[model samples]
Target: MSRILAILQKEFLQMKRDRLTLGMVFMLPLVQLLLFGYAIQTEVKHISTVVFDQSMSIESRDLLDSFSSSGYFDITGTAKGYAEITKMIDSGKAKAGIIFPPDFAEKLRKGETAPVQVLVDASDSMVSNSAIAVANSIGLLKSQKIIMQKTGVQSLPYDIRVRPWYNPDGITAYYMVPAILGIIVTMTMVMMTSMGIVREREKGTLEQLMVTPVKSYELMIGKVIPYIALGYLQITVALLVGGVVFGVPIRGSILQLYLLTLFFITASLGIGIFISNIARNQMQAFQMSFFVFLPSIMLSGFMFPREAMPSIIQYIGNIFPLTFYLTIIRGIVLKGIGFPYLIPQVMSLLVFSVIMMTLSIIKFKKKIA
Candidate 1:
């Protein structure tokens, strides 16, 4: 009993002297809570929409008003022609486009069937599916309202034409593959870097390295760079699997995806280094890595819908680095959106990277006691 107490006392003393590890043990959970709680929303709101109102009549205008008032579609601009609608979708200016035919009002007035065409960019299958469902429901409600006001007879007057672009079937794999790539990178980079340093500590190599003339920053760089290369390798493997096996198409520029992934990888590596600096052994490092990993998978809207979760939990999910990376990768790969549309996610990743790397470097010890 006394011998066990002695060992415990020695371990606690060592932990107390290692401010980095102590701080991490206390701070990581709290920080993760605040971040994931606010950022992990799944329910999509404020979808950008474009309208091509060829009818330009009271009925067409009233129907457009019904859509905009639903709170799902945000009417950003009006398209003058069918070509304009296609352009808006291709340029990533809108997620949905409503085209009213020239005979829409004429047919409605005569009680003849008319089709209202809705074009949706279905590259993001989840978002597109949601938008389509909402649009269809709105159309049904409007038709019912028109019947109730006119002849007091509720009946279906016209069909709402829904055209889903890019992915007609709304395949889950198409949307998930790009996101999985981001997850793969995060898992590899963080786990590899975190375990690498702790393994050195367990092997007694960290003590020897500390006694050398190499500075803390130099050692940190050496530790991180190799893992960055490994991250790229993992990314390559994930992309190949997504493409060749799952048949996920790369609609956007590969260069763009790679560049954005570089940024995300660096951020994840920073987190791993932070974890390694604080963990006393490989077991502790693995525990800490899992702590980060579980939340990332759940909260990042990877496998589950963020909106379906309670608001508080959704917010907690956003703090994981994977959450923002998922958004960036999905936007670029599925939507073909450029930097202008992706600035918010990229900035968040950059901020996280800077803070984590700074904390790790500042808390790093130079002398071996």
Candidate 2:
């Protein structure tokens, strides 16, 4: 007990002396929460739009009003012709273009189908999807209203309404901030711990540890305790920023959130220590950490849905500790789900941590190599 405590104190003291690492431990999460929280928006609004209305009639104006009132499209300016609309879109000044022909009003008056053109830049899938769906919905609703007025019908045969749960408004921050917390922990735990042992080895301090009485598991526990505290600190800062600045709701037990976080933190720390054991130098450790980091971000359903991915890719993602942690964090934070519902994910992370820690300890040599 005293040996483990001594190692723990030594690590903490060394960490305190390392100013740059200490600064990063405090600063990284806040910066990431602010940057990603504001930037990564799934529900795109106020898309820059251009209009070309040759009908010069109230009907044309009303159609434009429909698009504008939907709040998806923001009419920036009017285009003189198709050429100008094309130029605006091609030059990136507008994301969507609405073109109404001269006969648009006449066709509607005569009870004929009015042909209108909507051009969208589909380069960015998220922005383009919002523009396309809202534009089509506006046109559909307008047509339905016109039909109802002409026929004097009060209602349609079937009305299908959508009610979104959790985040009804589709606020991206609510969804992203919790996941960002998981990602922050993954980055620091893996990168920092992996580099720590490598740096010790590079500086020949690892030899000093070989002569000490501490066992490998004791060394591992002592090294990991400080980082566990650091992990909680990062999570607290991120949650505060997310809640105060972004209004992200915490629907479940805060105790559950903190307790479950332990499994994930230890899982990530184990992976880092495993990397440290395998790496020959700090540069190698960083490279290995980045190699794992990229896939954790990509395959862990951070930017894309695992359901939408190929079955093989989904299987690969399941191997990453971050994948399970993302589910646990988002489930507790967003859905208010608790223990029995989360048992599978929690168990998976536990198994992962145990396996990785066992491997790291086995790989760790007590003698100078």
Candidate 3:
């Protein structure tokens, strides 16, 4: 009991010695939250578009107005021909190009189908998809308007209404900020914890501790305690930034988030400890931590959806604790889901925590390598 407290005090003292690093740790979440919240947007808008209106008539202008008013396309410049639009897209000057045939208005007046070509830079899938969808919608709406005017129909026969829950505005931050919290926690636990142990080993302090009367598990717990505190501190800071800066609501019980966070933090810490046991120095620890970190970011559904991945890839994603933690945190923060709704995720993290901690404990020898 006293030994664990003594080790905790020692770890805290070492951490206090590096005041700059400690400060940086706290600031990590704030900076990343702001940067990622602003940068990562799934619902991409304001795509730079080039227009080539051969008709240059009122009908063509009306279609251009529809594209511009949709907020998805911004008419950056007018292209003289298909060759110019091709040059603009290839040179990265514009993402999309809208071209109206010379007989566009004539076809509309004569009740014939007008062919308007929309060229999109498919290099970026998101931008291309957005441009294509919006262009098609604009065409559909204008066609319906013209049909209504001719046929004298007041409204469409069928109405399909969509209700977007959690974030009705499709605000990227509301979805990303909470997930960023999980990321921050993972980075701190895996990178910091592993690096801290490796740093101790590099400084020969690990051998000094191992020579003491403290049990291996006790020493592990004591060393882990400080980082656990730091993990919660980071979570708190990230949640605060998510809520205050991004207006992400904590619709569920904050208590549930904190509680579920324990399993994730411990699991991450265990992974870190395992890395420390394998790595001889801090550089190795940093590199090895990425083995876990990169997978957590890519496979954990942080920036991408797991459902879209191949079946085998999705199964591989289950190995990362961050995968489960993302579900728990996003569920609690966005969906207001309680522990009952998060049993599978919580259980997965619990199992991971046990497995990783056990492996780390068994792998860590009480002697110098």
Candidate 4:
């Protein structure tokens, strides 16, 4: 216990001495919350669109008004032909092109299904999805309204209503902020711990540590405990900022959320410790951390839905601790759910922590490499 306390004290002192890393520990969460909270929006709007209306009629103008009023399409320029519309989209001047045939208004008057072409740049999937959904919805609604007016019927034969839970207005920040907190903790815990140990090894401080009476497990625990505290600090900052600045609701028990977060923090710290054991220097440690970081962001359901991914990729994502943590944090913060719903995720994190810590202890050498 005394040896562990001494190592813990040594680590705290080292962290204090490294002002830049210490600053980053506090600042990174705030910056990411602000950046991602405001920047990454699922409700895509004001897509730059080019219109080519060959039908010079009041009916065509009204249809254009419908598109503009929907707030999804912003007509910036007009094209004379499909060739010009394609060129604008290719040049990045527009994301969508709405081309109406010469008979668009005539077809509508004759009670025929008007074939107005909508070209969307599918390179950006999110933007494309938004445009496509809105465009299709606009067409459907307009057709329905026309049919209702002609038949003098108030209701359609079938009506489907969607009620979104957690976020009623579909606010992206509300969904993203909680996951961002998990991501921040993961990044700091993994990269900092891995790099810190490798740095100590490079500076010969690890050799000094080897000569001490402290055991390898004691060193690992001491090194990891401080980072666990730092991880909590990061989580606290993210919660405060997310709640106060972004108005993200914490519907569940704050105590339960903090308690369960211990498993995740420890799990991430173990991964870092494991990385430190295998890495020869700080550079290698950083490389390994980066390798882990990519999968966490991409496969952890942070930016995209894992359900949309291939079954093989989904299986690969389960290997990462962040994938489970995302479900836990989002479930707690957004849904306000409790332990019953979280047991599976919590158990998974616990198992991962145990495995990583065991591997790290086995791999950690007391002697100089």
What are the clashing pairs of model 2? none
Model 4 segments beyond 4 Å from truth?
A: 365-369
**TM-scores of the candidates in the order shown:** 0.58, 0.95, 0.96, 0.96
lDDT of 2 by residue, 157-237 (tens): 998999999989888888899999889899889998889878888999877886887686787778878888888999999
In order, the Cα lDDT scores of the candidates are 0.77, 0.90, 0.90, 0.90
TM-score of 4: 0.96
Clashing pairs for predicted structure model 4, backbone only: none
- Per residue, candidate 4 scores C-alpha lDDT tens digits across 16-109 of 9999989988899999999889988877899999999999788888888999999999999999888899999999999999988999889989
Candidate 2 least-lDDT 10 residues: 360-369
lDDT (tens digit, per residue) of candidate 1 on 1-369: 443344345444654687885465334333332333334444566789999988999999888888888888999999999898999899999999999999999999998877999999999976797799999998888877777888876555676899877666666567766776776677667876788778879999877866876566666666666556556765676567667765777877788888888778878988898899889998999899999998899888987878889999988986788988888888877787877888888898899899988887777744232
Error of 4 at 237 (Å): 0.6
lDDT of 2 at 249: 96
Reference-based lDDT, residue 358, model 2: 78
Alpha-carbon shift of residue 111 in model 1 (angstroms): 25
1-369 per-residue lDDT for model 3 (tens digits): 999999999999989999997998888998899888997788889999999999999999988998999999999999998899999999999999999999999998999999999999989999998988888888899889889999999989999999999989999998889898889888989999899888988999877877888787788788888998998998899888888888889999999889889989888988999999999999999999998899889999997999999999999999999999999988999999999999999899989889987787667645333
Give the best candidate by TM-score.
Answer: 3
Q: What is residue 308's positional error in candidate 2, in angstroms? A: 2.1
